[model samples]
Target: MSTEAVAVSAVSDAQQHTPSAPAQEKTVEKVNLLGMSRPQMEKFFEDMGEKKFRAGQVMKWIHQYFVTDFSEMTNISGKLREKLEKICKIKAPEVVHKNFSKDGTRKWVFRVGDGEGSLVETVLIPAEDKTGSRKTLCISSQVGCALDCSFCSTGKQGFQRDLTQAEIIGQLWMANYSYMEDVPIADRERSVTNVVMMGMGEPLLNYDAVLNSMRIMLDDFAYGMSKRRVTLSTSGVVPKIDQLAEDIDVALAISLHATNNELRNELVPINKKYPLEQLIAACQRYIKKDGNESARKHVTIEYVMLDGVNDKPEHAQEMIKLLKDLPSKINLIPFNPFPHAPYGRSSRNRIISFQKTLSDAGFVCTIRQTRGDDIDAACGQLVGQVADRTRRAEQWKKKIAQSNEIMRSQG
Candidate 1:
């Protein structure tokens, strides 16, 4: 059987054997090796009746040497490696699908265990102009998304569950190893230069796992990426934003699709719970606490320009005004349309005009070059799972009918 089919069947077997639970208490069957600090790994070994220092040796083999099998930790005894393998799974979700864009962007689709089994997407983007200076990996925090932002395909998938720390970190490990294996020795780098949590979910909602995964990525013995090189993107989960600053203190990016509250509420539905005023306040605090040269951080506000929606010059002016006096950078992304999404991409002239307004207002604004749209690899284009036709079709029909009734009443 194919790798994807085997993964699906394994998830199916799991669902048949175990019952579902509350969102906060979802059970992840195995611990992954993606997010573990040297100290934490040592503690794990100590708990398992091994010397604490053995954790460091194993961590070196896993993260630095990229060893996939515990038995390959030659420093440890073969009998101990066998015991560890029996009790813990050290591998990542097998890469089931791989797509590369003409612009050196690569996307990998992995099968994650959710109800009936689900999939998640991640991307590795190379710097433009052959800078050879940076390679960034876009990582996902959840299997799918619960935050149904009107413009996002992953949001449309509905919430399944959060990925454990292992799952989150495994993306980096697997991608790094795979890349090293593919490229010539002369062109290869030591590790992924940057990490962005902008792929599939509202990251702050899956806070703990995301933080744990980041700890591993930032640890000196592991990925060791600087806090400035790591960015946590959020759809304005207000309550957790401040805590994120206090805790991990990495680069922060906000998905600010609309300039005002009413429009924002329409685009990113979470704004209804935490409005613009509260969300900006959280950003302000995050900046005051973590923004500086030592941290090497900048608050990036991602504005998705939607035609006749948020692409107006006035909207651009308001965005600049809102962000003024704050240490920030604005990334104006032209909306990338997908099937079933109602919005269209903003016109090129409109996008340029809007960018000019922000730049003229003394804000650092750049238009993100759209990539991988031909293969559904652009922004808000990750719908990882194909819904089970017979079951979800009935649910979709009911949902469409309900929407029609609401629209009829409004009209």
Candidate 2:
């Protein structure tokens, strides 16, 4: 079947199997306040006949103080707190599983809803600088990916649905609390310094929820992270790239795995629609200066180095020509292996040669060090427990098992 046909079938199957609400009486669910933007919170308060400032006070309590219980919000009036308790909820996902790598990398598997396989994974990588330790949290926007990039394990899981704003930001909420549990309250600010929406799915595909979560990340009453510190990576979603720049100016990273359209079309299926030329043009537009000097940014070109695939010295020369006019840096990622993966990580000598080619051509290039490999939390290796509607997971498992059996027989 064609990809479009499969996607349509999956959507239909999901709707058919979804449980419907009773027709006699409707239950009103309390709003989750964890991911609400300042403006959204203000409007929420306005509906409750409260002043706009009440939203800010409550926001600081939830995000800054990490207080979910309304009674603990000392600054809020008792009557107002009572009202909020009845109408709003600060819900974070339950951490179903946690794993820590020897290199200080931590991964959390969170259950978003009460479904059988509603799990999503988030990773926290710790780094040190001149000041102190810094942690970067990688969060997911969807349960699985619709764009089945050949190189990504998450894509092999197939699409489920887009996460709500609450679910997306809740990952960070839980990560921050977990990382700072032992730190003094005054020193908690160093827990999560940066965030990347490059975890399980294509963030641009779930635009509104992702953007709303980003707003909460940048809010002074919440995480208060700089726009530069938050990044949203896309696998060449052209139109959304334009929309994202207009909506918010967070740093942009493109998953440009291949230098040419033929290879990218095979690796990143979305390239068939947007192609490489349109994608490069979009990247150029994203970094264009409007009025703010801070907005003049450089896009990070992410290239996963697969053995014998798009990692040759000639490929690097082509990349230099392709990105010469754009303000960007190359991030060479070594392919992280999984069961039944079709590619191998490029040898160290091959990677160094590729990097040298780009560097000699006057382009800034940095190789990304692989982390959390032992715990399956590295780049392109996140495959959370998704109740896949497309049945792609079952097919992949069968294929891998068969391949293994055949190899054993031959040996």
Candidate 3:
């Protein structure tokens, strides 16, 4: 599903920037501080007639120390803490269902947007890199998706709403907190070192919130994550790609599942609007870096291998041709099937052959190991409960039913 949805009504967008009221006020309005970046938080404190330095202190408490309660911030004076307790709140989405895979992958199903069954998921995967053990958190920017990329289970579930900045970054906050909650602040180290925005929704669609969340992630007082450690994956949102290059410096990944326009249009319907040529041009622009070849970065091309589709030698050769001039790394993901999914994973030999072709051509190619499939936490398996506004979920259900009936008749 697409990322153009907000779970709120007509006037909800304006509510994010409004100031909170103290407990003495009739409404006792509270502003959620979980989503605010350092600048926003500094403005918040300034507006509250407090010192701007309080922003860094509070941010360190909330992000580094994982302190949600204002009263628990001992270094801050009791009066200011009391005032903050009355008018401000550091809150994250509630974890509804938490599951762990045997392979050290963890998933959390979060309840968001008034809790009307609009669920989103987050995943934390532990792995080993050249440095040492690293945990990468897969964060979702939207509840469900609007871009119905035919192979994705979230698209079958349909789009519901764009997650608030708090909800978007809360997945990372919650995941990091899960590990450090029992440890002392001085001795605690970050559990999650990397983040990938490749889960659930198209992140660029929820532009502002996603951007602000990444800002907070890169802030030193907050998560202190490097721009290199955070990657934003999209289904070729062309204009946003350009805007992202201007706005932030995070690594970019394209969800490119096909080599040609005709097949891509069928697989990723958004390709109809932003075709392959335009998409590749945008990626090139994103990594251009003022044409300095020495400091140029590479974009990541994510291609999911299907049994008889997009996995043949011809397709690999076409991919090599498509990416010959661009600086990129190719990740070949095995198709993870969900209920009624129309595709199947390519065989190991076929995937190997495809990887060999690209690798032999002097491009970096790696196969993504299937992980957390049993718990439905693999790459394409996250299907959080979505209140489908597009009615795409109902249509998919009908389509599945028709396919099942055809199979039964043939039997």
Candidate 4:
């Protein structure tokens, strides 16, 4: 059997044998085929005593045609379709709430699990470039994040479980399906041109699901998106970065919020475990391939500009020295604030000055425009209702409350 087949079968067998809860909690769950890649699906069919080609037909139905019902697949025989309907499903997450920004950014709050608190947000951001207009869907990997990056609101919510493969790819499926409501599949143009795994959680933490989902995104039977157009952002997970280089090839972005070791350690706690030196070394290795488009592919250094935090001229100088060897383009993101957030957005002048330093220093740096802030769908602002498993949310709330009390008392 192929590697994908073995892995897929192992996952299927493991889930099948898992213990069920009591009658009150127990519910019939069908295999959701939404997340499976082509090779995995081929293996699934081979295991079921069906032709492997059935996998491609089913993939086109689910991803390309956006047909959720097995009955709608006219090409498959009635008997096989009936069997698939009985044992499997093509379900995506339920979208509970949706918001459209005046700037054409769309946000959806999806219920990924059974409870009310299982919500995760996905955003579609439209941009115009030299080529043409493009829409990028930001995908969430986990329900909530464990990495407590000081400025991000999602981190304030604390850790929750990693999202399954279905939940991960469902974001793209739903985003694209939204446009096909009125138009027929043949007439439908791709609504989302690119995808960025930069939403609610640290992506590298949820490795397997994320990798398979991304492979689906790149697969011709599915999204057929270019590997470069699909970017996966991580908060400096070093080992995964190396492992990722081996498993698949896609654009990688580092959440390098701060430049130096001390500031980065304070801002992104993951920095303490995987320091700037280690992360930089890994990045250098990641972009080392030759004689391909990936050879010219530079790692994106995502820096969120916080007022008096990491937006200083000295910080820009630090970034220059740090990224001197690595081929990277710096993206300066203006901080987006949320309730009781510790940091403020860097002033326009300060951000401009910082960008100028890098631009002049020969680093291709661009400031990220703050978008969908009205709907709280902007970067670092996605805070879906998380049933925080860590109790870190409670601690964070208490800390914020105390800070407010101290200020009020001083007044």
TM-score of each: 0.83, 0.88, 0.91, 0.91
Q: After superposition, how far is residue 72 of candidate 4 from its true place, in Å?
A: 1.7
User: Per-residue error at 271 for model 4, in Å?
Assistant: 0.6
lDDT of each: 0.73, 0.80, 0.83, 0.83
lDDT of 4: 0.83
lDDT of 1 by residue, 1-411 (tens): 432232233333322113323347643334344456565566556656678877677766677677767876777999878766654556676676788888778888877664446677888877844546677899998866777787777766667788866678778887787767765434544567899999888889888778877887787777778888889889899889888877876888999999888899989999999988888888878878834444534689898888899999789877877777667889988887765456788999999999888888888899988777655776335443444222333454477678878999999
Give RMSD to native, each candidate: 7.1, 7.2, 5.3, 3.7
Q: Write the per-residue lDDT of candidate 3 for residues 265-359, one digit (tens) a residue.
A: 99999999999999999999988856333223898999999999899999999999999989999999999877667789999999999999999
lDDT of 4 by residue, 89-120 (tens): 78899988888999999998888777564768
lDDT computed for candidate 2: 0.80
Off by over 4 Å in 4: 1-28, 290-292, 379-391, 401-411
Candidate 1 vs candidate 2, lDDT winner: 2
Of 2 and 3, the candidate ranking higher by lDDT: 3
lDDT of 1 at 301: 88
> What lDDT tens digits, residue by residue, belong to model 2 across residues 1-411?
432232233223222122323435543345667777788778666655678898888888777767788988888889977776765678888887888999989998877766665767899998887757778898999988999888888887787888878789888888878856776544555368899999988999999889989999999989899887898999999999998878887899999999999999999999999999999999888888364346346899899999999998778877988898898888999998876787899999999899988988888898988888788886435443433456776787788789889999999
- Report the lDDT of model 2 for residue 115: 61
